[model samples]
Target: MSTRLDDAYQWANSADGPVLVAVEERQDHELAAGSHRHARGQLFGSMRGLLSVGVEEGVWLVPSSHAVWLPPHEAHAGRSHGPFHGWSVYVAEPACADLPRRPCTIRASGLLREAVLRACNWPIDASTAPLAPLAASRGHLAEVVLDEIRTSPPEPLGLPLPSDPRLQRIAKALIDDPADERDLEQWAHWGAVSARTLSRRFVSETGFNFSAWRQRARMMRSLEMLAAGAAVSAVALDLGYSTASAFIQVFRRTFGQTPAAYRVRL
Candidate 1:
């Protein structure tokens, strides 16, 4: 990690400081922030490039207009797909009582984005005393940012993983090769489990049926490829979609926009 990032991480884990602190970052190369947890809740997003964040339960893909929320002490790691321009907001644990308890992807509203950017301008060591004028102003802005996060709808951008070792193997394979054409029965056989057992285990462990999980895996892969500058049609074919239109339809339904539109935003 760079000195700046190390400092940010240390600040986030500190118990006493600003109630809310925002950091804006721009990196020229892909970067990975390894697994770690902090004492403060966090909201992380990228305004340019794609981000893949992994928590205990699953992995979430955060696109340009979306952000991931991690409650205090949630172990997680992240990787940027390309050059990244983003911001991260860390909130004191006490102030995060009413926030979402689980990691999730939230649709970042314009107001929320601007609020975070504005907060990023304040000095990290700024006074946090309750009666200080600067502190008061910062408090109000923090409340606005928190309210925006609490009210924003979460996006369906997470791909939950199964806990069972058998299911884990299957999920890993699918993730490794989203173009795999294996059916449920075939996967069960390959995993050395009965078809019925595999089906039931998938739903119970991952909260998604085998087919749905595979679809989500493909969608996540598509997002990575798209963000890396692959052609829409090429991405479609590589992910096993029969045609570009079919992939576009699925992408639009899942992300509320076409792949090309998403790439343009990047």
Candidate 2:
């Protein structure tokens, strides 16, 4: 349940500068389910699993292709859909606001990934290093990557936080049981709301249709299993698909990658 600077912070703080840390084989439940912010801007990325970071209002999921940027002192807590190894880049405050303010999933281009790896070993005092020019070059590269991040389109599926208790209850239940066979009409009738009313409210609140939301939910669950190193056939069966081929088709349509490919990248 460590809730302080990540690896970078330890090194930086130890040397009175900056340190980048990479930790593997950790459980999110160990940290509890809450938000905590630090002075260092945080970059949370995992190569082999899904990570969820929640703020007061909404929760953002980091799929394989993306990472989350947390500005300095902006309270947030992270959870994984499955087992994961995380890398954190503890950048200084001056670099914080250059990242996104709200929660977003930014794609990790090859250049961006290399920048992160380089930053991990950044000298505690690069400002005065003999390779000062190299440090400056890395800074410029980071800035360029951040700019591209800002311009890139956010992930296609985002789980919007719902305000209404009625909707929240429904959302939670669905997450708990993705195989729940009830249609929106059945749910609306049970909730004493007409199907049309429920559909409109869902769109207004979550920006996804009832069916679309359910599909995303199912896909998200599958992603977790894949990240956990589950076999494709087993994951598909767990998600209620008739066969692995059906699951693969849906996954390809939604994420543009097969489960195996995504898992391999992770």
Candidate 3:
């Protein structure tokens, strides 16, 4: 664990070209919220396991084959949904100035991944010959990643954070147990706030009404479960839907496709 933490720190500290540090392994932990507002842009690649990245607007999941590219000084936190392993790429700020200002996950094409690996290990030298090809390749790979993110479907999995501490606790509880049937009144009682206040506070912090937020959360959780190959009936049951058909109805409505079809497509 210490060695891996050291590696993470080193990867963050080393800034030359676009550095790619693959997560060789990881154990489960609640990656606390904070920002590493570096001079360079950061791309978090999670080829295995699930991760969550919180930006100013919302929290996004970084699933396998997906990565989040955070523009410099965007104020964000890196979270792991479970155990995670992948690369962390630190792109030169000048090179990444044009990247997306918000959180996004990019496709990891085979060639692009290799280019990132090469760029990460590039050595600083006086000779400008061998470095030219590496620089060109890194630029190409960054372009590919950006293009993929732009074209990829805007997944229905973002659950925005609640800024208020009380509301934040409620949101965290929902994430902990999506099956919880606690109503606004119950949440208010738990939070020691009035129902009206709870409702208003929830909307004020998350930018979505309670039902809307939960629906989005359910959709995101369902997506994660589907990606893990969970059976539709089981997923529905686990998410507290009365029936699989009911869950499928909501899933299709939100995603514009049936869960089975979506899973097959994925």
Instruction: Estimate the TM-score of every prediction.
Output: 0.65, 0.62, 0.75
Q: Tell me the spans in candidate 1 whose CA falls farther than 4 Å from its real position.
A: 1-3, 22-37, 45-65, 73-88, 94-102, 108-151, 189-194, 224-230, 252-266
lDDT of 3 by residue, 1-266 (tens): 55544544444444542333333334565444466576556776655555667776666544454457677656777766555555666555555555666666654555556655654454433222322334566566656654554455444335576767787677767776778988889988997778898788778777788878877777777876876789999999998899999999999998799999987776
**In candidate 3, which residue pairs clash?**
23-86
lDDT of 1 by residue, 86-118 (tens): 999988888799999888887677688889999
- State model 2's lDDT: 0.63
Q: lDDT by residue for model 2 over 1-266, one digit each (tens)?
A: 24332433453223224222322335543233466776666666776555556765565545555667666677788665555555666555554454566555666655666666665554444234222234456667556655655575655434664546777667767766777889898888776777887788888877888888888888877876776678999988887889999999999999898888887765
Off by over 4 Å in 3: 1-8, 11-14, 17-19, 45-52, 58-66, 81-87, 94-98, 106-157
Candidate 3 — number of clashing residue pairs?
1
Model 2 clashing residue pairs (backbone): 7-21, 8-19, 8-20, 8-21, 12-17, 12-18, 12-19
Clash-forming residue pairs, model 1? none
Best-to-worst ranking by lDDT: 1, 3, 2
On lDDT, the stronger of 2 and 3 is: 3
- List the global CA lDDT of all models: 0.81, 0.63, 0.64
